[model samples]
Target: MSSRERVLAAVAGIAAVAAAVAAPGAAATGRHQDWDETAYRGQIEVVRSDDGPSDPTVLNGTVFVDRDRDSRHDRNERGVAGVEVSNGREVVTTDRRGRYRLPVYDNMTVFVTQPAGYQVPVDEFNVAQFHYNHLPAGSPELRYGGISPTGPIPDAVNFPLVESSLTDDRRLSCIIAGDLQTYNLTEVEYARKGAIADLARRNDYQGCGSLFVGDVVGDDLSLYDEVKGLSAQTNGPARFLPGNHDLDFDATTAVHSFDTFRAQLAPAYFSYDVGEAHIIALNTVRYPCTPDLDNVDGLRPGCNDPVNRPRYNGHIDETQMEWLRRDLAKVDRDKLIVIAGHIGLLNWADEGSAIHQVDQVREVYELLHGRKAVALAGHSHSIENMRTGDAMQGWRDLFGIDSLPFPHITVGAIAGDWFSGRVTEDGYPTAIQRDGGRPGVLTLDLADSSFQERFTVTGENDRVQTQLGLNTPTYREWYVARSAWNSNPVGAAPELGDPLVVDQADLAGGTWLTTNFFIGGTGSTVTVRLNNHRPRQAVRTQPMRGEDQFVGPEWSDPAAVAEQLVHGGSVANRTMHLWRFELPTDLAPGTHQAHVTATDVHGRRFADTLTFQVVAQR
Candidate 1:
């Protein structure tokens, strides 16, 4: 069957399953559940104590070449020396015999950082199996079954690797997808048709593959298998990180919270090397939230709740910091370091919200020190390409981060707006993100230590970059009316006042052209030309000069608000990357075509056109 047919089949299958299953009420804020809580409660005995293994247990492992493509390490296959291994906290290098030992504790994950010029074994779902969970007593009783109790630490936990030309090549393409937050089987089908199908047809990124930054599922950890099945459709190996929503909130301690996630996916944090970059996937989310005492109210969502209740915040523990330092120490400073995390280090969407930005932003910045680096994260559904030196008042006041030390990007989510919106012709929701970006994935093309990043809208080609529209009084008035209608069930959405026809009065009253550059940021520019007129620079709505965010119709993306407000999704109230141009009042009443060109920070340009008519009066 063709790709479209396959997607439709998957959607139909999921709909059938949804019909057979029952739905549950929404859980905590930002969490959606499909299974009844009482059904799985107390099913598995909670192992709350740390009595399974003594602290600092000796854990040994070997990295060897697999000659036959099998995982087993035979005598014929020799060991590869100098490969790195970690037990979440400590980092070590294999000796000449390819043997490495690290102090492991209960609930620790022992993983190998697949060295350059070699690759690790991948499971049936194409997920890299370079790590082993060492939770001797297993996880606390979780709604979804977590890691089973492993009675004892193994004598040797070997890692098998194969040599491939993909890793050795100087040029590489990597896919980064943020928040595939499928809340239910229906949303799962939405993902299957959207980004998953798009990834299935792509042949690129077979080397570095795809790294899902976080929020693999909404709150239903049970959907991991379905998520993995989607990964199987991709053309390359898949790796994942745990987001706040992926946690088992019932767990008493932070160590056991992500047990289910680890059992199903990869470890919360790990590193791997391919081509010229060292990809460090960091677990920046801290559960049962702990923040600086002074900023606890600002960072923790339920800081005022009962102390026992679970909350989450963005933080990188001291142990992970030490491991990061050791990991970076072994790498060449010139090599590119790609840091992936669930919560962003810094972002424009949550400029004033301390909880969304990493608490240890300065520490991470200092850890990278002299290395070339770029950070990718996805908790906020908006797409932001923050360049170095980008500044805002909140980051400076709360995190003491005066300016971005390096590039930090928030990749748009595959399940944008929590997978809410009207279904499209392709059997998926439009799911326009809050920033007005359509659901998509970001691909980073790397050569040596440098890289250029671009976003691909699901089921669309690379050229579909910017969305254009006219921002007039009529549009703004309709925006408010439509938004109110969406919020209240009583009113009908009046047609968005004519976009193609602009009255002379509206032009004289300061109507302007708007361009929503989804992935645009500092160092990016938008230029517009009207009916063969000279190209004029369009001014960005928000100036990233340590100022507060600008909101409302004047700052919103008209093209995005048009659909978002009518359908069910977040209104496009504000954005950091939208640009606007004033219309010419002297133009005669006639048909006009406006050509818009958006140039990204890396000098890559994308063009889009908008045609509208100038009328004498409405």
Candidate 2:
């Protein structure tokens, strides 16, 4: 077993007692099965005012350290000083007495930034309760139960925090999961068996916790309760960021678009501190976006028009931008800023599209000018570990970004390809991503300010990182035919006959060993060696050097496409992780084994092998 595995095994004893403690309100849901006892019951204490709407301008709160596992601020309890509090726009730190006062608005979420060395109380569903939503007039008629009428301004919204050694430790394992877009209860079950179960099995992530970067459910927001049941099973506190799909479609304006998401999951955007990492989770998807605020003209020109209809755009509003500026000011310069959002700042899959990329890309780059930071995002189902200086044309045209200022990683989705494709024996779908990556969760193993990233494929260990296949002229032809058939349901699906057997014509034309190295990017390298021969450096398919997307059948990953096209899901047409090593047109026509090794920018290496047969003639 690995050293990390050993540490995780040893953690069970220390955590067993905590796991035995049942959450106070878990029975209310009647759904917390595997981790009912482990569920956290504590929640935010919203104290109402006797003055009603007379004194609704200002709000006051105390962040108290909750001992005895109760969600109340007793007279004997002490207050946690230096914790930052925000009314969404303005940020303020707690005074020496741990008391804070902020100007209030009717429709705003008042939350506390979870400071290091302490933990905010979580609900029965393991959702951290650090915020109080105050909406005086309720929501403007919505489907999925938007916030209930929060009558008047509260006298105090005391935030209850508990002392936790798990969050205080310098050794942190932060799990970044993307797009658990469960449209129905069945899809929710798939997520439970897949990534949720994977998290429950691991005990090492208690400190930094798990942050799901949006699309908690599909369009139907009613499934939030079912998804939260899955969240209760996780070993760490669950945090979520809203995505485009998580928006309230009935809402007419951008401000109220995520009302239901905020009520169900968390604040639209928030920040938390764990060890030396200052994690900023931003809500980048703006629903009912206007043409002007989209920044890039013509990109989303159909905002308020009857013809095109207003849709969600990749943007950060003025209010959020202001909050981010203030939030970064409080963070220490030495701390690693983990910037996470739904739609990424820039990505390889959507490198040319404005809708998939963020509009405030340049300003965000300026915000973290010299600070040590890494951007994490979802939206794009593909896994990308982009390094600094990696450039793409879509980013240049839409946002005028020449190269990445820091490492911007697009964490692969939990519900891979919308949970499409055939069901595997393990009770999950074979949802291969668009860039040919399998469904998985990302982990950042942090020691102080520095970190190393690792991707864990669903139902597989860390060692199983890359997928191996052979791309030949014959396979390319089949890919083209099958792709055309997928566009329109006509004729029988084309078959890729004997992908391992490359005939004389294939060897003469071209045949190459392909490695779909998930999370591999610029600075990363892949090499191939056949039967004791010297390793040949395989060329990366996409250079990520300011160019349009390199797509087609030749660039497609045959291994991933085989499952996607035949069953269901997006075709693995273009990818940044694919590396090709052309085979030599030599004489030997027999069974051959090719060894493949992928080395990331951090120098961590993963190995995979593929065996194929070479025939004399077709």
Instruction: Pick the lDDT winner.
Output: 2
Report the lDDT tens digits of candidate 1 across residue range 570-594. Answer: 8778888889999987978999999
lDDT, candidates in the order shown? 0.81, 0.84
lDDT of candidate 2 over 303-355, digit per residue (tens): 54522586777789889999999999998899999999999988778887777
Residue 139 lDDT, candidate 2, scale 0-100:
86
Best by TM-score: 2
What TM-score does candidate 2 get on C-alpha atoms?
Answer: 0.92
Where in model 1 is the C-alpha error above 4 Å? 1-56, 291-301, 304-308, 489-492
Q: What are the candidates' C-alpha RMSDs? A: 8.5, 6.6
lDDT of 2: 0.84
Instruction: Give Cα distance to truth, residue 130, candidate 2, Å.
Output: 0.4
